[model samples]
Target chain A: MVSAAGGGRVLADQDVCVGAGQCARVAPGVFDQADDGLVVLLVRDVPAGEVDAVLDAVDRCPSGAVRLGAPAGGPY
Target chain B: MTTTDPGAATAQPGPQDDVPDFPVPRSCPFSPPQTYAGVRERDALTRVRVHGGKHAWLVARFEDVRTALAHPGASSDARNPAFPALGAGEQQVAAELRPFIRMDPPDHTQVRRMLVGEFTLRRVQALRPEIEAVCAEQVEHLLSRPQPADLVADYANRVSTTVICRLLGVPMEDLEFFRRVTSVSGSRTATAQEVGAALQELFGLLDRLIDLKAVTPGDDLVSRLVNGPLARGEITRTSLLSQIGITLNAGHETSRNAIPLAALDLLRHPDQLDLLRADPSLWPDAVDELLRHLSVADVITLRVATQDIALSVGTIPAGDAFIALLAGANHDPAVFDEPERLDVRRAQRHHVAFGHGVHQCVGQNLGRVELEIALRTLLERVPSLRLAVPESELPMRGASAIFGLDEVPVTW
Candidate 1:
């Protein structure tokens, strides 16, 4: 399988979430950490404009899990 | 940890007492610190004293400078206790917070590749129309303001900030906040407390903005980062935040200075300015020439010798510090005929102003785009713009590693 460094990193909130959504705070529209802590992707492919934000997400991932790939997950 | 001079490392030794200081104040603001001319002449591995009396080899010749930056044995890791600082003292910069420029290999490579893709030739070309719009907007804004405004603030800073903010996906509403934080964080005289406070404000702001993006990601760089790989757990939140912190500043700082400095050079050399205006096609080359001539970056980041590295100057022993004085290297007559003169036609494409090697400025294409647009727009809109104050009276950024005017007042 070809390696995909990172596609657009998004937030997926589970029922365990407490609703303190910070991901939505840093990146609105593309991600939404809803009240009650439901995180969801606003879009699938990274918008042409939001590439910088995606890169920022990689740097900001507190969990140290954010990947650095393009949207659509093409070969890096 | 111990004091050594670049001269001491050289086979030809100057008197120990005569060890020249690094980061010496420039006698003329247009050039590197005055001492570099002499250092460049020696061209051999020479030791120079830095803050805390530590020594670093100064590389000046163009070819040699490029070699040093590209060498694997020379490391950019600031975490190394002996890593040289351009500031007066080395302070503890947390590891996770260190910018990608200060990182070495695998880590630097990984982070840089991610960021580099954002500034590819195609990406920058795509950004041209937006960059031009910023330039036009700033010029119109300047025209509407009273005569004799501060171009550095009104035009240069505004255009650069706008381009960088847009390129990095910073919200337009927060431009003022971004501007204030960047200025404060980069201030040479800012106290630790002041810097920390400003940093705290920025961090808080980013966290809130990031959370917003988490829920409703937009078409911005930050949003892309946050929504993409961030969801996949390929990188870390701390890393993303750290990169944003650095990008917020790096994105604007160079062009902020370069646009005005290049303008000043042109204004002083009216013939060159006239040549550019007369032949509009030359604007792109003029920008490149200005980057080469002004070489506004005082020095490349300090590198530590990971192993004994030999060069034209001499051998840099393992653990020794090294820096390439780009200001001097850009002037090496070997590289350009009449390097001191601002020849808009100069075709030299390899200037190290944006630096070289793996650690070159990631936003350079963006910077160039801003510079080209800002310069052309300012000239076209304010054809008669001239310095409102005496050049000698203008305060240049002092003793700081970078070279820039604090302000450039202009009248048209």
Candidate 2:
């Protein structure tokens, strides 16, 4: 389970999110739920310290809404 | 219940050779159905006979189950006629009511969106104190009871009923009415007419309550919906009624079953209970583990393929009904190492017990909060809580849509 330590972005697609709120619960620092229960990315860039949390959020997202994007330079 | 055409089963994905029953009952009461393991071992989708002897594809593997649920070709619309219903009555009633749970988007999306704000993480977190208070009050009631109290009837049922009622602004005096409603409507043996009658009364009650809420809105979900979606004309009064009905039912049913069953599971494994008792912080993860292990609401994830959808394992042809067994997915050996054993610290959180895709349980946040509080309060307040009867003697509900214990007789 490699942490998202390589500079990468956290992408939350509202279209795909079913609003299960796993992201907000598992990684409150990086994700939050909008009023409509859709995922709201609090921070676009994953912080070094929050990498593991972000990874967990990605893994736990039921609808595949939350994902770890490629390193900053690569295609998102 | 109509039997499937003999040739139809052969036309499906799996072999024409011997199709076992659809909802293979759990032999151990607490474990997944015995047939699932054999079904999962096969490469093709295993067709099984449902309530009506109708053929349905059983998606029994973890990855395949997820794929089936999340697949765009899959349809939850009950009107499809092929939608798998363990109860003969459910398909007709659900098709008539058109609850969002049985509808595909954008209809499902629109209805669900209007209600999601009410159950957001922030909102549920705010409701924690009230949930905790409810659990604490139930504890007092349980403690006052004589020896060998039924936790299912005495505590779990009451806590779930009160919490859902309060959330929906339903008067407590009518709690027993709801018990009847759920019982009649949830029964697999109930005829279509009986289920319709039960829901008719339910709708009537909500309709009257909606009128009252419109006049004098409160801080509850019913009032919020009455003042917002219904008032705005974005949703019809009829649609609003069914939405609230489904919400109220879904809100409580899962928790009512999960709590005592989880308690029983923990009690059965004293080592797991001791671990949680040692570190109360493990309660949240432990709750998740319990939900995954129990997977009580396994059968509710029923669907029909609107179009042929190919997965890595196999394809579900169009118009074919399928049931994504949540228990099968939860107990998958590939994802969950030693799936049967209860390990509270198991880091897995992607269980389909709340289900998958857009139709996932909306009240799940609130559900988690209530379960955590209810179990923690019970464990803390009654340290000596143990089964009053032998574990083998407890009655497990095998006929209903939700898996649960009929009564958990306990004495501390």
Candidate 3:
């Protein structure tokens, strides 16, 4: 069910997004948060080196809304 | 899935009475508690006893710690009946305030939004020149004072205290009173009642300040809140008070300790200092690395599981409490290679030092900017700075949630 979009997916599940901004903090180039504090995608084709930080963001997200549907190297 | 009553949540899956203390003692100042490292090696999450014999799972490994904090089932509201209190009477204070720190979702987002713009990188950048000026003034004060200046008092305290006071709109004359009153709550040895009383005193002071801001709005944070959210009926007066109180606590404490901690670490590793001095661009990255390397006073924000969830290591049933041990996570070997050695050129940007998720420190951007400016100014102004006393002899702060120093005696 979790698959990549384009080269990879930067998924922010709307309901689960709590907007703790961990995603934005970890990979600001790839993620951002709205005023209501929900994670927003800045860029979907996440760069290669930033993948670990992106995963770190998805993992640390207070609400667990983020996911690597199609991580650059492989599936998360 | 097992379920328990709120109070029974304190009795989570664990050996009833045999884990090491919550603020695990460190063998040396820079090292993570030996127990924490042990836990990280054994399991991603382990239950341990906190200050008041409260049992909560300790999420140690980097991935698991992040999983625990960001879990949908996890809740930070200490009032959540199930949430674990760090110490005696902590629940009372936490629940009473129900500040944004304790609130879940919508309320947390809403309350935090009211103050977010003030701390964004852009905002903190705009405030940098002023912070630099303050840091310069404090450095001058350190230079002028008697030899072997207490860096904690002359530099760290003066810089952070003055900057925060100005940001919060405290009158210059009242800064000493507010600073002294605010620190009473950070006392680890103090009883919960004593800390509560101190917080109440802070609330009262904030109340008067809020009232003044209400009548005559100023450029300060409290004034902005009074005129924006409170006046708009978006947030209650009590919520505003809690926000201000928590801000006052976090604003000064993180930097007050961090500036000194980073300085101490840099002094100990003069080679790293030389690297940073050679290339000033390394300051921001170095600051981030230090924040990760130094977990000043633990910031494992406790959360109660609202439902059963498999936490990689174990399944935490509904109503059990757990904390995201940033101190432990920062050093997880899986995340940061060779987590120990102080390398200023290190480039890992993501750290839970200011915390993560919607509940991350609101003032983190400000904290970072302050550190960057203050440290840069200090190194530039006082190139010969060194510890005045033996590092071992320097007194560390007592058992407080946020670890800090009593005095950082140093000299140029």
Candidate 4:
């Protein structure tokens, strides 16, 4: 289910995260890493200004862990 | 999904004579192999002959290379008969030791998890002070040397070796020994026997260090692995040694090659160097730009397909070997504007120089920090640094696994 926040939904799956920290490095405003180096999402909804950076994080992430969720009311 | 036996597939057909040889040597140290420009221009997957006269699929476009790497069907397992080992001993080394970089999931994941915490962003950030100190010490050594000093040997190698040694908790008493080991193990021309001997000597020392760390652990990578993974039975003693060896080698080799090559790039383009000097904040971006430009570890990222994988350019059939040319992807004009130009403020940090996918360089954060500090210190301290000899006369390691200059003669 989408968070339905003010901005687009941002998803980070810790289970598959390889802890490469590309997300945290590429989009620090939206993502961080735990002490164990797993991805920890700081924001559920991506701010408009940070969308490009968040997209870059998705592209740069070695593991398919960080991604943008489908728009609200879109297919699950 | 049907899995074709790689051995059977290889036995069926030989590569066409038209297939170009893999690892076309770079005409200039600052650029990738001149061949990559033509390959990338095709915007498609191509076949190239590798070790043992075998053909492997080569992905050169930026997006296609990333796709090949990110695909789960791509396997790093060296045991696969179709796996490409650029050097004679490389396959044997990977098969015998089973380093996680040459492993697939579950196994790769298990070993990688135990080490990621050590190289996290925050953890590496904390090492900035120590790295700065190492660079400062090396710069002083450079100053003490006579004019026309060898920057590669005097400063770059020393700083990299010292930093990695401290991180691994290895004593600096055997720096020369470690250098000899990497020189042989990393050489593409080294015979299987020579590489085996070099690795044996290295493992012998690491074996002793692991034994010591088991009983007397410290706040270092070896100690942590000793206490955490080995004690937990997640990894065997032999595998642990292999992991540490790769980390130690990786921790230094890329940076050792990068530092001197990057300095030369700056020396070649004084305007870019001036841009960095004026706004010191641009140092980090400059380091990345240099890494992208130099692409020293161009041919190191080797892979083979486990299942048929489709790319925008073409489909890589299962049981076939493949390689993602990092140098090609980094220089793709479609991805980078004026790819040949070295712009410090390029704002492009997505280069695959550290590689892409799960097996990307684990020590990348540390590598980034180390390079940033080393180059910045060199430029900041030695403002008048310039090439002591014509760039044409500089010796390059043309056929080695890692690309770099044998010596960068410079004076201030």
Better of 3 and 4 by TM-score: 4
Q: What is the interface RMSD of each candidate, in Å?
A: 16.1, 1.2, 3.8, 0.8
For B156-206, candidate 2 gives per-residue lDDT tens digits of 989999998898898777556766787777878788899999989988889
Q: Point out the worst 10-residue segment of candidate 2 chain B by lDDT.
A: B1-10
User: Each prediction's Cα RMSD?
Assistant: 11.7, 3.0, 4.6, 3.6
Instruction: Kindly list the per-residue Cα lDDT of model 1 for residues B163-248, writing each as its tens digit.
Output: 87776667666446766775666665565566667777877777787788889887677888788767778678878777877887
lDDT of model 2 at position B329 = 91
Cα lDDT of candidate 1 equals 0.69
Tell me the TM-score of model 1: 0.79
Give the Å shift of residue A47 in candidate 3: 8.4
Best by lDDT: 4
Candidate 4 C-alpha lDDT tens digits along B59-121? 888888888898999999998888888887778778877888899998998888988888899
Error of 1 at B329 (Å): 1.0
Score each candidate by Cα lDDT: 0.69, 0.84, 0.74, 0.85
List TM-score per model, in order: 0.79, 0.94, 0.86, 0.94
Candidate 1 reference-contact recovery: 0.00
Model 3 off-target regions past 4 Å?
Answer: A1-76, B1-16
Interface RMSD of 3: 3.8
Per residue, candidate 4 scores C-alpha lDDT tens digits across A1-76 of 2233436778888888988888999789999988788899998778777878888888899888988877656663
lDDT of 3 at B72: 68
TM-score for candidate 3: 0.86
